[model samples]
Target: MPNNMTAVFLPGNKQVDVRAVLVPEPGPDEVLVEIKASCICRSDLSLYYGNAVISGGDSNQFVCGHEPAGTVVKVGEAVTEFAEGDNVAVYLAVGCGVCHHCRVGIHYLCAKWKCLGFTMDGGNAEFLRVPARNLLKTPKGMSHLAAAISTDAFGTLFSACRKVGVNGLSTIGIWGLGPMGAAGTLAAKAMGGRVVALDPIAERREFAESLGADLVLDPTAPNALDQVREFSGGEGLSGAIDCSGQTAAHNMALDAAAPMARIALVGENRETTIKTSDHMIRKQLTVFGSWYFSIDEYADILALIKSHKIDLERLATHTFDLKEAETAFRMFDNRETEKAVFVR
Candidate 1:
C-alpha cells in the first residue's frame, strides 16, 4: 500500500475535489482501518450546502465522509478487543469513555464527543484511524455497503424506536421516505409494528411500499392526515417519527400522533416550529430529539442484521469508486438514488 492516498473534499458549494493526503496512523487506543465502503448521508449533503453544525471553513479544507465499513489493518497497543484483519463498521461519534455521559452509555451526550468526517478526518479516503471504542464487529454475511450504515442509519432508527416504546403490534407513522425513513419502516416492521409512510416524492412512496409499509401517503395530498388517522382506526398513530425535518412533516407528525404518544425528530430543519399550546399541551405528547445511537444499542442492531430480521442490502442503491465520489455526491444531491456508497 502507498504511504498516502487520495480523498474527496467539498471545499464549497458545488465544488468537490480529490486530493492526496498522508494516511493516518493509529494511536495507542486507535485502530487503522482500510476503508472498503463509505455511504453518503444527508448530513454530508448538509455539510456541502453549508448547513451542518460542524463545519470546516474554506481555509481549513476538511475530509468529508461519515458512514464507513472496512477491515482493520492495524490495531493500537491499547486496543485488545480488535486486531488486524478484522472487518468492522466505524462509529462516527468518538466519545471520551471517562465522561459522565459515557459512563452511563450515552456516548452521544458526551461533552467531548467528536464526530468523524465533521470535526475530524473521516472515511472518504483509503484508510482512517478511529478510536477502537467506536468500532463495531460486522456480521459475517453483511456487505461493506450494508455495514456502512449500521452506525448512523440503522443505529439511529433503532434508538428512535426504543425511545418511543415501539414494539410488536404498535402502529407507526413515518414522516419521510429517505434512506433513514425507509430504514425506520423496515425496523418497525421487524419489530411487528405496522408502518404508515409519508413522503412528497412518488418514487419514495413506492420505495416505502416495497419495504413493507402498510400505507404510503403523499404528505401534500388533501386529507393526508385523515389517511393516516384512518389507517390507525381514527385514534391517530401510536407513535410518529419525523425524518423529513420539514415544517409540513413536523406538523403532520403532531397531527398523526396519539395522545401521550412519542415523536422522534431525526431530521434537521431550521425553519420548523411546533406550537406548544396547539398539540403538545393538549395531547400530552412525549417528544424526543434523537441525535444518534448509544453504543449499547449497536449490539441489538447487529443481532437483528445477523438474524435476518432487518434487510440492509436493499437500502444501498448506488455504489461508486472512490475516484467517482464527486459523481456520487451529485447523484445524492439530485435525489437520484436512495443510498450512495463509495467502494474502495
Candidate 2:
C-alpha cells in the first residue's frame, strides 16, 4: 500500500479539488480500508452546495462521499472479527460504542454521532480508516457498487419501513421518488403492502409504478390526497413516508395518512414546517425522524440481501472511476442519475 493517496476535497462553495494527503493509519479498534466503491448520496451534495453544517464549522473544508465498500487492508490490534483482504461495507455513522444510545443499538441517536464524509474525512479517496464495529460483511456474490448503496439508501429505507410497521396488507403512501423513495416502494412491496407513490417528475413516478406501486399520483395534482384516499377505500393510508424533504410534501403525507397512522420523516429539509396540533392530535399520527440504521438492523438487511430478498442492484444507475469524481457529483446534482458511484 502507498504511504499517501489522492483524495477529493470540498474546500468551500463549489470548491472541489483533488489533493495528495497522508493515508490514515488504523487505530486500536479501527481498520484501514482500501475503498473499492463509494456512492454519491444527496447529503454529499448538501456539503458540496454548502447546505449542511459540517464539523469544524462551515469554513473548515473537508473530504466528502460516505457510502463506501472496500476490502480491509489493515486491522487494529483489538479487531478480532476482521482481517486483511476481507471484503466489507462500512456504516457511515460513527459513534462511541459505550455511549447510552450505542449500548441500546440506537447508534444513530448517539449524542456524539459523527457521520463519515459529513463530520469527518470520508471515503472519496483511495483509502480511509473506520471503526471495526461499523463494518458489515458484504454478501459473497454482490458487486461493490451494489453493496455501497446498501449502506445508506437501502439501509435507510429498511429502517423507515420498520418504523412504519409495514405488513404486506397495509396501504402505504410514499412521498418522493428518489432512490430512497423507490427503495422504500420495493421494501413495502416485499412486506406485502399496497403502495401509492407521489412525485412531480414523470420519470420518477413511472419508476415507482415499475417497482409495484398500485398507483402513482402527481403531488401537484389538485386531488392528490383524494387519489390516495380513494385507493385506500376512503379510509386514508395506513402509513406514509415523506422522503422528499419538502414542506409541502410533508403536509401532503400527513393529509394522506389514516388516523393513528405512523409517518417516517427520512429526508432533510430546513424550510419544511408543520402545524403541530392539527397534524398530530387531529389525526393521532405518530411521526418518527429516522436517521441511519442500527447495527442489528443493518445486519438483518445484509442477511435479507444475501437471501435475495432486497434487490439493491436496481438502484444504481451509473458508475464512474474515482478520477471522474467531479463528473459523478455534477450528474448527481443535476438529478440526471438515480444513483452514481465511484469505482476504484
Candidate 3:
C-alpha cells in the first residue's frame, strides 16, 4: 500500500482542495477500504457555500465524500465480519454503538451522530477508514460506480418508496425530477408502481421518462395536478414523495394523495405550512420522513437492484479522477450534471 494518498476537502465558499496525505490506519474496530468510487451529493454544496447542512459540516478539514464504494484492503484486529479482499460500500452515519437507534442499525437517528464527509474524514480519497458496522457488502458483478450510487442516491429513495408501499397497484407521484426524484422513478418502477414524475426542467422530466417513469409533467404548469389526477384514473395518487423541498410540492403531495395513502418527505426543507384538517385529517394520510436505509435493509436493497436489473449507473452522468475534484464539484454545483463521481 502507498504511504501517502490524495484527498479532497471542501473548505467552504466553493473551494475544493485536493491534497496529499498519509493513508489512514484502521482503529481496533474499524476497516481501511481502498476507495474505488465516491459520489458527489447536493448537500455537499452546503459545505461548498459555507452554509453546511449537517452540524460541523462547515469545518472543511476532513475528506469530503459520503457516498463511496470500494474493496476492503485492511481490517483492524477487532473486525470480524469483514476482511481483506471483501467488496463493500461505506454507509454515511457514524453513531455511538450503544445508543438505542444504533442497536437497531438506524444509526443516523442517534444523538451522537457524526456523518461521513461532514464531521470526519470521508471517501473522496484513495482510502477510507470507518467502523466495521458501517460497511455494506456489495453483490458480485456490481460495479463500484453502481455501488456508490446505491448509497445516498438510489438507496435513500428506495427506502422511502418501501415506506410508501410502492407496489404493482400503486400510482405514485414523485415531485422534483432531480437526482433523488429520478432515482425514485427507478425504484418505484422496479417495485411495480406507476410513477408520475414532476419537475419544471424539461431535461429532468425527460430523464425521468427515460428512466421508465409512467408519466412526466411540468409542475409549474397550470394543469400539472390535473394531469396527475387523470393519469391516476381519477382516484388521486396512491402515494407521493416530495424530493424538491419546495413548499408547493409538499402541499401538492399532501393535497393530491388518496385517502389513507402514504406520503414521504425526502426533501430537506427547513419548514413549511401544512393544513391540519384539510391535507391530513380529511385524507387520513400516513406521512413520514425517510433518510438513509437501515443497516438491515442493505441486503434487500442489493437483491432488489439485482433482480430488477436497475441501471444505477445511468444516474452517474459524469465521472472524474480524484485530482479533478474542482472541475467535478463546479459542474455538479452548477447543475451541469446529475451524479458526479470520483473513481480510482
User: Clashes per prediction?
Assistant: 0, 3, 0
Per-residue lDDT tens digits for candidate 2, residues 202-250, read 9999988988899999989998878888999998889998889999988
Residue 9 Cα positional deviation in candidate 2, in Å, after optimal superposition: 1.4
Q: List model 1 lDDT by residue over 1-344, tens digit each.
A: 57889887876576678888988788999999999998888988877776666643441366778888999999999999999889999888778899888887777677777778887778888998899988988878777887997778877887888888788869999988899998888888877788999999999999999999999999999989888999999998989888998987888899888898889999877667787886799999998788678777888988876665567878889889988877888899999988888887
Candidate 3 lDDT, 1-344, residue by residue in tens: 99999999999888889999999899999999999999998888988888787875455678999999999999999999998999999989999999899999899999998999999998899999999999999988999999999999999999999999999999999998888999999999999999999999999999999999988999889988888889999888999999998999988888778889999999988788888798788889998888889878888888899999998999999999999999999999999998899998
Q: After superposition, how far is residue 320 of candidate 2 from its true place, in Å?
A: 1.3
Evaluate model 3: give its lDDT.
0.91
Q: How many backbone clashes does candidate 2 have?
A: 3
**Would you list the C-alpha lDDT of every candidate in the order shown?**
0.85, 0.84, 0.91
Higher lDDT: candidate 1 or 2? 1
Output the number of the lDDT-best candidate.
Answer: 3
- Residue pairs in candidate 3 whose N, alpha carbon or C atoms collide under 3 angstroms: none
Indicate the worst ten consecutive residues by lDDT in candidate 3: 51-60
TM-score, predicted candidate 3 vs. hidden true structure: 0.97
